[model samples]
Target chain A: MKLSCTIRKQQYQFSSVREVLGKASEEKSGDQMSQLSASSALERMAAKVVLSEMKLEDIYENPVIPYEKDEVTRIIYDDLNLTVYRDIQNWTVGELREYILSHTTGRPELSRISRGLTSEMISAVAKLMSSIDLVLASQKMRHQAYCNTVIGEPGRLAFRCQPNHPIDDPEGILASIKEGLSYGCGDAVIGINPNNDSVESVTRLLRMTHEFMQRWEIPTQNCVLAHITTQVQALRNGAPISLMFQSLAGSQRANEAFGVNKEILDEAMALMLRCGTASGPNVMYFETGQGSEVSLDSHEGVDMQTLESRTYGYCRHWKPFMVNNVSGFIGPETLYDGRQMIRADLEDLFMGKLHGLPMGIAPTYTNHMHADQNDQEIAGMLTALGGANFYMGVPGGDDVMLSYQDTSYHDDASLRELLGFRPLREFEKWLEKMGIMENGRLTERAGDLSIFD
Target chain B: MKQIDLDHLVQRVVEELSKKSQEAIPFPEEKELGVKNPHNREVLEQAMRRTPARIGIGRAGTRMKTTSYLQFRIDQAAAHDAVMKQIEPAWLAELGLPELYTRAKDMQEYLMNLDSGRFLSEESVRWLEQNGDKHKDVQIIISDGLSTSACEACIPDLLPSLLQGLALKNVSVAKPLFIHRGRVWVQDHVASIVRCKVVISLIGERPGLATAESLSAYMIYQPNESTVESDRTVISNIHRGGTPPIEAGAYLADLLADILRVQASGVAYAQLRVK
Candidate 1:
């Protein structure tokens, strides 16, 4: 197919589909760090023009990383529905973008088409969409998954109450959990990132959270975001685990760096199904970001955005209950500033939804990056408007242990009010019974942790 | 009314306003609970005492109350400023530290480009070759990493105690040098030049809303091309709020002595100790 285009009398030639995809992507510091981004604004536009004319079959035939060498590529190809692929193989990337945004393309048609598209194809079309384009297209597709409580149902939003502690103090963690619950923020899960990753520490934190949930009769899940192996040992030791957590990368080498493999994940999922506290099918919670592969030095030659999509492809294998995309978590070296962070958030939300996963946006920023609370709020609002399934609820938007900022309990409550949404069905009832939430709004008795006393 | 009387009245109002402004209410302390009329205030206060996470801050209709909102902003602003601010040159000179620089030309380059902060400049390399103390048992490096405020706050107290601890142990320590806009990996380069067995880098951490003066020490034993992240041992959150600088200094010295004895650092050291 054509791989060259002339814009403003400047002919730009791309040698491969990988080159075109990288250059056509929006400006990102990670891609620039790898020296894969387009050199100039005009050249970027030229690459996008060339990519728009390329057919779906062209990208399908040429994966960025070859299928034989990469497990992520193999998993994506192995899981594709070839029947659906053959029907739309000849459509141009430009046509695919329009079809996704068309008024008639509802959730059913989008879901059917999603099974055919590879992760590369999803990344390709996302490069052509603007901020609003990503949001509008993302709004049409909402994928639901179930654990103890249902996630991603229409007109319902959820929050993972991330009550992290710096020293793995159980009493401190329980206190934060109480505070989050009073704000009606713990519908998705009460996931804690422990400073200590030992099996004993993970098991202790899990037991504490599980006991607290039971004591309050709260309709939620409890998770300790230690390494998957550590969680497995904890589970074997009889700790109550509601959701299994792991940080995923797009490539095999990067996954290796993270000390995870497909085999390990498979065994973990089987264990969760057999003995975990959560009910059925979706028991995994994954956190993915764009620059992880590059930072780990495992992104062979692919762009950050494309690698992130491949991560989603690998993630959907477990049928995760929550896929939290934390694009700006690394630093300015990856996202550069608020604009880039916001862009990555929108793109990740849309891509995860297109992959038929229950997606959440963390919309996080570190202190070193040139981002503040305003930029994070903008991302949270835009993704919430785009029908994101869930978000993280840190206390006052600060994670003391992780040393980053995420959506806070106040932001979580405000998102529901802004979108006229409610928490999960069971959680809303619990909040009403406790006099914390009514008519999808927090009541007068909310925002006081002592109410639990 | 007469114009003169009106002018006098306006002057008196301005003076009264200035006096009232000068009597400004002190900003609310972070420890003071923000929740109003809790069901059990004692329980809320006890919970607030447990963790530094911002809880018990009552909300205004699904938003932070005005005082709490401003407090969060002020803390965030301090963190941002810490990353952007530079360590004072006069202070570095006062410590008798020979200054070096990374390849980064400015703060923007250092923040955005990882490689720029990973290696020394040509001038710095030559300066080290000419003047650096070589073949020592340990070489210490101080860098103003993400937060220069951290270095400015902790080094004066931390450095003296660390040197005293090392001297008491009779460790052959090289003169410490300060590197501007450098990351943890720069210590490897310094080690390669000075030919030290153990190299330690006391660098600033990315400022969090809790404290901007936090620092971290990354120690590596005989860094080579094969050295991975696990080869380096890190002791983080060295600040007044977390681990006090003076205490971290003595602790690091003792840890260095252990590393020298075991011939390892990081995971290897931990494993060997267990064995």
Candidate 2:
């Protein structure tokens, strides 16, 4: 594909990073070259960052945007032309390949983003592509992995209806489940985080969600994100265990919040494997993020990115169903803002996928956090483009109980429209039968329903 | 002959150390956590299971790790937002609430005059007196205190479940009401005028990042103008992210029943056990 800019007179095309490098080296380093070597025509232009020699500052405070509201942050957001999300989405395969390879590249005018477009971050994109001979080989491997697992397909995502029922009301629990599924969720796991961490509470939600699943004939697993002990109790009480779920962090303190350690996590995995009540391909689901260790005050001396990788190291021990990192959920203090969040989102997926986990993305944001729906959509687009195994599908990008906007049902629809991704095989069939989806496209009927009715 | 390349390695290390020395570098959240005492993890985790506080998180050199530091910041931000955040009146309809005000007219006035928010505006008092009975057995109110999301998130599940439980018990329950920009003390003002045996206000709590949707139920039996915070008993952290709103609602019903049976609440209610 050929990429051209409106303002610049230059037009050039090359298929490989080597070709771009050859062209780049021929020209003087400081010259304003509009078109380099590869693909497509763009109405807008984006400026890119010129990566300096490997400086120590780049590691910790390279793209230094603070969490506190300030002038720089205002400029970062207010700069309308710096459309990282839009620019990246429009970039060609050749552009992405060269962009990942070149450290000294600047963005097109509109591409002057704060974080994800950085050479430092795009290094992850490089790691993601195993080699030029077999492009998206990792994605194929990921698809194969999912096929082997219970989920059975990449991009066939799942979401838990974590309705904070202050009291474990079965009706309320069912409402959340129905609400999630009506919005085209429940492709992966239909789960609830029991508000009260009691065994009884766990069992009640299990029965409620299970009843909904059967009534609807939705092919899904039921999970409750309670403590492992509560899950164990639920198991002993003969409660069904489709996806044994927990929120895990690499640190002892972070995992301790969920009442888990490496040893305990292993034990729980063993216990889950033995739990007779099963439904899905894999038996476990885990949620993690960039700042979990920070939330628990556990990051020792390692950077957030490295610390996150270590957490993934812990998660891989399970080799279970899915591992999701709400890349931007930690707010801006550590991640700073949307730019940082985007970068972290890319890095986390790269690392998670590299570590041999069936990766999922939950693009989340809080009101006071560094991101919002716009930011989440950008991150979601990137993940969708990056070939994430799956992601959380929520209603209107809103998690009422969690008080954050995660990846929305609409986002899933949009991504599938853009990238041609679809949900699990069985759920897809169920959707077709429900007439919400036909062939591969979501019907107008899909968007019109209300669970309240 | 092989080149050692000690100079290159030393140069890189020196550069890293120099940058590190310029600014504080935090350790990873889980670095060397249980090296000295392996049991320390179990100890720390055991304590952590009980509360969401910074107890045993190891430090990075002389400073806190980036995780702990950010955690502190997020918590601080959450608390700050809880105090200063504004809730709009338009969404009250979603919760099946008709917005009512105290003496304080707006958020600024409410923040400035805590006592004013406790007392209903004259118009509101007149409306209440005109439409409602004075000697009610129990009055339930929902308020947006510190965290609006708390009430908005929890009350949907909490109120319905609670009302259902109370109804099943054949308990005398008044029409549910709301307090926009209301405080815990406001229950006393409504209770005194209504002459209720018990008043329960499911209000928002001081939120942390991890528990922004947490709600608190403050119950008082026969609360009057003289009622203080100590006179009210609270069942708190009621949200989907904490205690399930339905569970909190159900539990609140049991607690409110006890208060009604004993004709006492809070500290006194604890002393006078209800049948």
Best by lDDT: 1
The DockQ for candidate 1, computed on C-alphas, is 0.51
Sliding window of 10 residues with minimal summed lDDT for model 1 chain A: A194-203
DockQ (Cα-based) per candidate?
0.51, 0.02
Give model 2's docking category: incorrect
Worst 10 residues of 1 chain B by lDDT: B266-275
Worst 10 residues of 2 chain A by lDDT: A43-52
DockQ of 2: 0.02
> Residue-wise lDDT of candidate 1 within B190-248, one digit each (tens)?
99999999999999989988778888999999999767655777777788766689998
Q: In lDDT terms, how accurate is model 1?
A: 0.90
The best candidate by DockQ is 1
